[model samples]
Target: MEDRELLDQLFSGGDASASAWRAFLQKYSNLFLKIIWQFEKDRDEVMEKYVSVCSRLMGNDFAVLRKFPKELGLKSSDFPSWLVAVVRNISVDLHRHSQGRRRYPKALLRLDPIDRKIFDLYYWQGYSLEEIGHQLDLRKNGKGTDVNESFARILRMLTRYAPRERKATFPTSVPFNENMFVPDEEEPRVDVALFDKWLEGLPAEHRLVVRMRFWEDMSAVRIARILKIVPQHRVYAILQKSLQKLRTHVERNMASN
Candidate 1:
């Protein structure tokens, strides 16, 4: 059956359609597993959290699920993409709660949840604005969403005063890793190997540019120069496509592993 038809059936209060949704979830169960795998916690905790996120979405109103495609401007062909976005958003929230409680200096401990995440992404992850933009798939002309607005918020938070920075009590990198960069404190470890395996079947150019830019750290200018191709502003689109593929890839790999 078509997605819109299935959605119409679901939203119209067909109770038996619950199984249809269940089948949809089952079809994409790997996506949920990938989000949980990102947490990289204990196996049991991982399973529990994975199930929790799924249960939340499963019980979510059918109207809510139906709204996603429309709200995101996703096409019927883009159903999987929309599905993965929902899964990732849930996973990020789980990581936020987990990080907030980790052992830290009293000053650092006082930072708000969002601030901690921004700080983590900036200092710990070492992601540049462009890279962060690429990860979130932000683009110029406000492609779907405004890039400038999101980063402006991020910069404001990053520069926001934290008590720890004020106190000079922030631990140095070596000791900091022990305290702040704890693996379990973040999301589960992504299975890069399994993710790569899923992408092995994708088109070569798609896979190559992605591997070059992200995994190999080649800049778009460099990628264009290397590939002897004209550079366009749509590097983000290329990267976004690759990452989306990996996102789904990660989702599938997480479940299997």
Candidate 2:
């Protein structure tokens, strides 16, 4: 069926299980799958996100389809671009949620500036030895040490200070009005584990900016240069987004548990 016909059937408020819906998905499934694969390379991960995108599109009586501007009289050719945009957004959300479940070791927090940058670029950003070497000016046959040796040393340091699981207890006592305004008697310890958990929830670029700024103590100008971001303002914007995600996650966890 043509895109307009399928869209007309969808918005006609008729039965959703009609052939129009099936035809729509059949025609667009490949496009959506391609966009999903762009975000996730693994076969399993790609399939999972594709299924999620389908579910979302089909949910609420085809709510997403209903959002389309039918008045504009969209053509069949326009459908692919529209569908790609939708699928890409869904894939990004899925990727972010998946990343959120991971937690970096607290040992990463203690690394010195250079080692930390090497580890973050290599592991967190998935940069290769050569790429990292180029970015950090650690190119072999130059003034600096070999990238491979530096990376191995960072790995050894991480292993040496590997994080150990520990349980923490917080007071449950409720303070009255006067003491409520005052600080707790005991100093509140920073929960590196919890912080790491929140950090993982951030999008890849956002996490990179946050780590560079706070963990690596690099200026935004330096971060923009290292990350190859065009403008310094983008680094600030990413930091804002990252902090907002972390704050929201903390609030949700507090409410849930």
Candidate 3:
């Protein structure tokens, strides 16, 4: 069955269909990992986030998925853009809550200057935008105003930050040489140049989704969390669309070569 049909069967109270979908995901586990890698900072976090997302999303319960990835001031096109947005917000929130009791944040990487400030105020300090704006204006006359505007802009930019999220991808993506259903334990080497060229043709947002879901092995629930305010169906749709594009790309590439 197709992913959407499987989802419908599961969502409409079919336990067998849900189990079938789970098996399908497990069978194509590598593809799911690729999808997870886009947002998670490291393999450890990726595993943690994936398990968390899957636990929340599977079964007949989609309450959290429904409410999470909250729909802020977003346009229809901006919905897919919200994937990384939601994940960043979740990371920030996780960081903040950890730091409250002087505990170490779960984040593996150090935030940059701007990200640090934004993380502090928005998540750690629990300050509102208007409040942040007021404080920025006080720190330095015109500079403070700029900071305020920057803060607002960052919020807006984050809402639509697609390409910037996956700018730090590590060396991944092996070629589809062997037509096997499962991944090889050892380095099953393949053509790197062809894979790179294929990756270049993908849309940024679609590419990010593919990397996260397929390469990184992230779960849809975690994806939903990162995209904090979006509906699960929306996230699923984005992923499905990306997969379709990728499937078509692969088919054409195979045909040509």
Model 3 lowest lDDT segment of ten: 102-111
lDDT of 3 by residue, 1-257 (tens): 64434445545556775686576456444643455565556899777766554554453465433433355665434533353454444444443543434212212022223433543454334455566545433334333224454454433333323323433221122222222112323332333554455557777765665566544445555666775727755556665565345446555665676
Query: lDDT by residue for model 2 over 2-52, one digit each (tens)?
Result: 776787787676674477777887888888888888778799988888889
Worst 10 residues of 2 by lDDT: 166-175
Model 1 ranges off by over 4 Å: 97-229, 232-257
Instruction: Give the lDDT of residue 131 in candidate 1.
Output: 61
| Candidate RMSDs in order | 20.0, 17.3, 22.7
**Highest TM-score, which number?**
1
Better of 2 and 3 by lDDT: 2
Q: Native-vs-model 2 lDDT?
A: 0.63
lDDT of 1 by residue, 86-185 (tens): 7777777776875644223232233433334333444344455566555544453445333355445433322222233332222221112222333425
Q: Rank the candidates by lDDT, best first.
A: 2, 1, 3
Which ten residues in a row are the worst by lDDT in model 1?
Answer: 169-178
RMSD of 1: 20.0
Candidate with top lDDT is 2
Regarding TM-score, does 1 or 2 come out ahead? 1
* Shift in Å, residue 215, candidate 1: 9.8
Q: Model-by-model lDDT, in order?
A: 0.54, 0.63, 0.47
